[model samples]
Target: MSIFKKIKGTFQLLKTIDLDQLAKLNEKIDLSDAIKNLGELDERQLKGLMKMLTTKAKKGQHQLPPIDGDFYNLDLKLSKEDRDIQLQVRNFMEDEVKPLVNDHWNRAKFPFQIIEKFAKLNIAGIAYEGYGCANKSFLLEGIIAQELARVDVSISTFFGVHSGLAMGSIYLCGSEEQKQEWLPAMQRLEKIGAFGLTEPNVGSAVAGGMETTCKRIDGNWILNGQKKWIGNATFADVIIIWARDEDSNQVKGFLVRKENPGFKAEKMEDKMALRIVQNAIITLTNCSVPESDRLQNANSFKDTAKVLQMTRAGVAWQAVGCARGAYEAALKYTKKREQFGRPIASFQLIQNHLVEMVSNLTAMQTLCFRLSELQDQKLLTDEHASLAKVFCSMRTRDVVGRAREVMGGNGILLEYDVARFVADAEAIYSYEGTKEINSLIVGRAITGYSAFVN
Candidate 1:
């Protein structure tokens, strides 16, 4: 080939690296002087240089088509109305959330601005009647979770804490007065909420090992103890704090308002994943709440279990979204990324990686779809949600690993978007319950052997 075509091919490969890489490359060799040196070369030397630059041994370049997820067309399963809802969320995530995700994640800050825009969707507290909530299906709720998690898991975490954990706690356990007071504003995003069940010493054992104490005093409940890993507690309007009743020794829930003088919430920092979520350590030093604020129907730990059961399905769907985001980003990158004189997607080995990712993503989506069906049918149980959570979270870890592997070095950078998923997957794997806990729940149910305490 002539020098013009040879240089063009060389530059095409060089385009793969950005300005920072170019600056680093300049430290070893000056690009301007090198280009000038090319003109001085003899014909034989130029041909040899061209061979070295383009590696003439490689075959011709070929453009590969773009890769996408949802190979099975799972979206078709939804009704027209639900499909429209999915598109509405997808468009919102792409437009309002996508551009700001990386920046907020990098700064470890939440974009408070999005709350007003998000409230307009009126999706909070779904599946509950009245309270200004949508009262939609769990399937649609799962789809929304997937959409939020696709762009940013931290936002999904925030939403889950508010919509699923906090609001669901009240919906399932609070009285009509409690629901009427909080749900409407919460659904509209005028009031933010947080769920405080996980404590520093009480994580997987939140059901039975809760250390926070609530005591009745002069017609008021005085709460004391600490809660760890409480999402949105730092700025939430209300935090549903779970405490053991000193007199009864049973776990009870309380609607702890944010402004209580005895309540202290310190922001937990230096997180490696889901940095945008403002998790906090909450200390209730004799925090006083009126008797009316106590969850009227949450008489025992069993009530907490009810709220968890209702929300665990959403966690499974969030894992699916996390995996899908990574898969889609990696797939797109591999297709456009030129390697060996052609797109990497053309390579048989690369195709294997891409196929595995989409396969797992599709399988997880289908599983959650059925899981939601069971939930809507009122046939869902602890074991059912536990199974889905274990499978999806574990599979998501695998999918994100493959995604990172396919992107090579670019996979780890936040700018490329796959790294966040890889990190956020850790949080998802441990959210609601860890893989071990969820598996145990399913194991005991199937085998008729209790293993939680032992």
Candidate 2:
């Protein structure tokens, strides 16, 4: 019998039998034997016993409440259609991606087979308004990002590179003809894309220190530089390359095709986090492209900042997902793991850890929600995105650390899931913009001072 049913039966016996009456009944009959006799008793006797137990159980109904992290019922705020999409994405991640993620992550290989299945969700460029996009709100986009990262950060990164960084580059800066040519097929997963901006020598300082150079000659542009940590670049059909024009000294974006004779992308290996993402070290040696292939509106680094501002909010959402995944897994394990004849969750210290994890998770969810609201309203600024990124990434590290602490040794094992988040959190902390860089962004906005070297 369930412990709950046993407790209810004991309570019912206590209410009717005093110590003297119980002693007299015990003398007349063994409790175990009486229970067996009762089982074999007539239907009327069984009904009486069951009725007593049910009554006691009804009184104890609220003792063990359901486990739900979103205590505030934030889900109720979502539209029915949006909530359905959120559940669909969550189900997809739990069923399809969760089972095979650790193995692929250990092997550091992209699961190309799942691309077709993922595309069927029709979530790429979800918030964009045109070119076969879903035209969903930014709230839905944030939910999708969380769902993706909850299962595997690498897949989330790959999706962000193609759907957000690369496709967003076109959506925000490319000509109308370019969007019509690329966005539709790309949305359908017929053409994959990559973004190439950070170079070997220039990462956070790429704005003014971009070493990637583009020289215009004979109606063609020759791109010559190396891009490091370029996710999906090796197999991408088209790469959005950002480089400084040699003559104008202003950064410009170009649509560099994979078949270009001078373009070479080699796989970067031995990564400790986001291992399933196939980051590439790309070398451009006079990679020739027609002038028409250049991004029409990308006149300067300010244009690139617009794309980063949009996607950085998504990264914060991804961090929240990572933390939530770790917390849930740890919470479930603690309730079942036993020590000294009791559940570990019963201990005050373990509960403290769980509470702390949930607190951080709740804060992150609320912050990301507001951040997406600002985005949907078109009121989001660089400082807003940076602040969210800074806070969420930092808090995620804390949540994952507590998750690991509560799980004990199993936390370090990949099969348990929390270990991967711990490692992946490190990568999220550094990418897009480092903690130092993101903090500087907020500092500059609030203080009206530039701390970065120009």
Q: lDDT per residue, candidate 1, 187-219, as tens digits? A: 998999999998898674866678999999999
lDDT: worst 10-residue window of model 1: 58-67
TM-score of model 2 vs. true structure: 0.86
Q: Give the Å shift of residue 48 in candidate 1.
A: 44
lDDT of 2 at 35: 65
The number of clashing residue pairs in each candidate reads 0, 0
Candidate 1, superposed: residue stretches over 4 Å from native: 1-67
**Weakest ten-residue segment in model 2 by summed lDDT:** 39-48
**lDDT, candidate 2, 103-173, per-residue tens:** 99999999898899889888999999989999999888998898789878888899999999999999999
Best by lDDT: 1
